[model samples]
Target: MPALDDLSLLIEAARRSGEIATSFTGKTAQRWDKPDDAGPVTEADLAVNAMLHQTLTAARPDYGWLSEESDDGTRRLGQRDLFIVDPIDGTRSFIEGSDTWSHSLAIARDGRITAAVVFLPMLDRLYAAAAGAGATLNGQSISVSDIATLPEATVLATKPVMEMQHWTKGDPGFKRAHRPSLAYRLGLVGQGRFDGMVTLRKSWEWDIAAGALIVTEAGGQCTDRTGQPLRFNNPDPRLNGVVAGGDAVHAALLSGLAQTQATP
Candidate 1:
C-alpha cells in the first residue's frame, strides 16, 4: 500500500486507541510492574494495545507487529513491513491523571518509518506524517522552529541530560524543558513549539519511531544521540538514544553529545 494509505490507517487506529485509553483515565484501571523493571503498564494500555493489534493486523495481516504491551518475539524480524506501537506512551502520567500522555503508532517498512501518528486524546492534539508528505497537526501543516543556534534554542530534555559532564566544554546554556512522554516531546519539536529535544537514555523503538518521522517530515532532523540515523524494527527494538531539532540545533546537540563520556 502507498505510505499515505498506510498513514490513513494509522490515524484511524490511533484515534481508536486514544478512545480506549481515555476511557480508563480518572478512574483506576489495574496497574502493575513488568518483570524487568521496564516501568508500569495499566489495563488501559493493554486494552488499547489489543484493539490496535487486532484492528491493524487484521487489515494488513501480511505485516508484522511490535507493541509495548505485547510480548516480543522474532516474528517481526522476518517481515518487510510492521507496526511499531506504544498504545500509551506515558502510562505514569496517565496513572497520575495528567493529560499529556499519548498514543503513538507507526508503520516501518524495510527499517524506515513510512507512516506515523501520535495522538493525545485528552489534549485533542493529533500529529501525523507520511514519508515525503511533510507533517500536520489537527489537519494543519507544521514545521520546526527556525532557531539556528544552541544558546538561543529552547530544548526539551530531562534534568539529568543537562548536567555539566554531558557537555564537552561546559553547559551549552540552552533553556531546558521536559515532558513525561518521549513521543510528546518529539511532537512538540515537530509542531515548532520547541527548538529541539534530547534523551540520552536508550529509547524504545515503539516510543520514538512515530515521533521521529513526524519531526523529520516537519522539516526537523532526528537521530540517535551519537548522530546516527534511526532505523526501526531492529532485532533489539531499542535505539541508542534520540536527538531531534531543526537542522542547526540538531548539529549542535550532536557536537555536544560527542564530547560527553555517556553512552546510550
Candidate 2:
C-alpha cells in the first residue's frame, strides 16, 4: 500500500487536472485532432496532460509515464511504479459541450494497478480507490447494485449496432442503455447508477485502468469478456474487451451470453 501522503498528493494532482479540463468544456477553440486519424484531442487534453505529467513526475521522479496524448516510452518497464493517464477520457463529448467525459489516472506497480482516480470535473465527482481500501465517489464510499439477472440489469453499452448485435444474439433477455465513454459507463457502475457495462472493442490502458479498480473496489467485477482478470503495462496497451458489473449480474451476464451462443 502507498503512504497516505502519496495517495493524497495524487488525488490533489488529479483534482487540479480535472479543473483544467473543466475550464474548456463549453469553449469553442480548444478542440483538435490527433495524428493518424485517431479522433479528437483538445487543448484541454494537452493542458491537463502537461499538468499531470509535471505533477506526477515531480512527485515520483523515478516512475515511468504513459498517457493518451503523449508518445509511449518503454522506460516505465524498468520501474515498479508507473503513472497511466487519460487527460480527457471522452474527448468527443468534451468537444461537443457535453459533461459525460472525465479525467482518468492510475498507478501501476509491477503490471498491476495499485491505486486509481477518475474525476468528472463537470459533475464535481471524484472516484478514488487504493488496493484493499475500497472505492469512493466524492468522498462517499460507493458500491455496485445488487441486481443478479440479465433481465434485471441496466446495461450501459457502446456502438449500438455492433454491441447490440453481440449482446442480443448472445442473450435475448439482457437490456441495454447507451453511454459513449467507457470511463463514464464504468464509473456509473461503480456509483450504482448502472447495473453493468459492456464494451466489445479494444480499449486503451488509459481508458480502463482506473475505471477497472473503481468497479472492482465498488464490489463489482471487471474482466475481459472471456471472464479473465485485466492486466496492465502491456506493450499493446489495449484491452481486448470488458465485462463489468456486480458479482451476480456479471455471472448471469456471462452465463446468458454463453447460453445464447450455445442454443441453436
Candidate 3:
C-alpha cells in the first residue's frame, strides 16, 4: 500500500473514507460538542477517523497524521510528510441531512501541501489535485473562472463577511452566498461554481488544506485573509482565515480584508 508517491494513495484512501462517512450519514449516531469548543463530533466522526487512520497510516507508516478527529501528537511535528484530514467537513450540515459535507484529505511535506482530495459522497463529486498536476472534479479537468473583481463576482461567504466594509473603492460588493462546509466552498470555487470564497474567522488546516491546493491547481489564488500564502501541518494547525478563488476576486477579497482589519 505504498502508493503515497503523489496523490495516488491519498485519493484511494479518500474514496474508501468516503464510504465510511456515508455509512453513517442520515443515521442515528452518538453526538456531542467538545469541551474545547472545537464544535460538534458524532460517533460517525470517530468511526470514520479510525478507518482513515487504519487505512492511510498502514499505507504511509512514516507520514505524520493531523486530523480534526485525532488528538494532536507533538511527535508528528518531527515528520517530514504529514496527512491532514477532516473525516467529515460539514458535520452540522450532514447531521441536518444536508449534502455539503465531504471527506477532506491532503498531504503536506515541509509545510507545503502536495496532494489533495475532497470527496462528497452525497453529491458523488470528487475533487482531487496534486502539485503541478492540476485539479479535477469527477475525473474532468477543472479550472477557476476568469471573472475578476468584486461586486460582479459570485462569492461564497458568511453574512458577517458580506456586511464588512470594502476598500476605498466602496463596499466590495459581490453576489454573496453561503455554504456550511468550508472545504466544499473551496471545492465549489475550484469547480467554478462560484467566482470566489472568503471567511474572516479562524479556520482549521484540516478544513482548508485540501481545498486550498484544489483551488490553486485549478488556476485560482488562495491565501489567508491577509493575503499570506497558506502552509499546513503547523503545530497549531489553525490559520486566521481563507480568501481563495479566481485571481482578481482573490485580490479584491484580500484588499477588502486589509481595509476592514484596519478599521478602528
Candidate 4:
C-alpha cells in the first residue's frame, strides 16, 4: 500500500471535483441517458468525470482508472494502484435539484479499497477514510448508531416500497426510511443518523465502495446480502444485497434479512 500522503491527494482531488460540481448545481444543462436505461446521466456527470480523471491522472500517472463515465478496461487490474470513482453518485437527485446527491471517490490497491472520500457539495459534507486511520465527516470523527434491535433501530434503505416486499410481509416490527442515493444513505449510517441500511438489488462498485469504508471505519459493518464483506475490481461490477449498520444492529438486520430470504 502507498503512504497516506497519496491517499490524501486523492481526497483533495475529490474535494476539488466537488467544487466543480457545486458550481453548476442550478445551471441549465443538457442531460442524456446511458444505453442500458439504468438511469439518467447528465452533462454534469461527464464534466465532473473529465475533471476527476484529469486531476487524478495528473497527480498519479501510474495509477489505473475505473470510473462510471469512462469505458471499462481491464488495464486497471494489472496496476498496484487504481482509482475507483463515480463522478456524480446521485445523478437523479442532482437533476431533480435535491441535495442528497454526492461525488464518490476511492483508491483500491490489490483489489481492496484502502482510502475513500465522498463529498456532498450541496450540504458541504466531506466523508473521508484511510485504512487504519479511522473515518471523518467534514473534519469531525463520526461513528454508527448503537441500536441493537430491529424494532428500536431506524433503517436507511432504497426502493423499499417496491423491492423489499419480502421484509414487510414477515416483519412488521421494522421501520424503513427512503433515501435517493446509496452514498447518502450510507453516509447517514456512518454519521449515526440512521441505525442501519439495506439494499436488495444490485448496485455499482463506485456507488458503495467509499461509503462502505466510511461506515466500517466509523464502527459499523457492511456486507453483501449473505453477510459477506465487499470486494472491488471484480470481473462482475454489480453488487447485490448490501447490509450495513452498527455492530449489534448489523447482526439483527442480517438476521431479519435471512429470515425474509428463507421464507417461501
| Top TM-score model | 1
Tens digits of per-residue lDDT for model 4 on 1-264? Answer: 464776688678877887777777543657887886768888889989998899888988998888889999778778888888999988888888888788898988777778888888888888988888888998899999988788898887654523445443466355779878788788889999999988877778898888898899899999987787898887766676688999998887776663334211
Query: Which 10 residues in a row give candidate 3 its minimum summed lDDT?
Result: 255-264
Residues 115-194, candidate 3, lDDT per residue (tens digit)?
A: 99999988898999988888999989999988967867899988777553534555677888988989889999999999
Per-residue lDDT of model 1, residues 1-264, tens digit only: 599999999999998988788778544779998887889989999899899999999999999999999999998899999999999998999999999999999999999999999999999999999999999999999999999899899999999898887888679779999999999999999999999999888899999999999999999999988888999999988898899999999999888774443354
**Per-residue alpha-carbon lDDT of candidate 2 for residues 214-248, written as tens digits (9 for 90 to 100):** 89989999987768789898887887678899999
Q: Is candidate 2 or candidate 3 better by TM-score?
A: 3
Q: Higher lDDT: candidate 1 or 2?
A: 1
* TM-scores for candidates 1 onward, in order: 0.97, 0.91, 0.93, 0.92
Relative to the true structure, candidate 3 reaches a TM of: 0.93
The per-prediction CA RMSD against the true structure, in angstroms, equals 1.3, 3.4, 2.6, 2.8
Off by over 4 Å in 4: 1-3, 25-27, 159-165, 258-264
Please give the ranking of all candidate structures by lDDT, highest first, separated by commas.
Answer: 1, 3, 4, 2
Ranking by TM-score: 1, 3, 4, 2
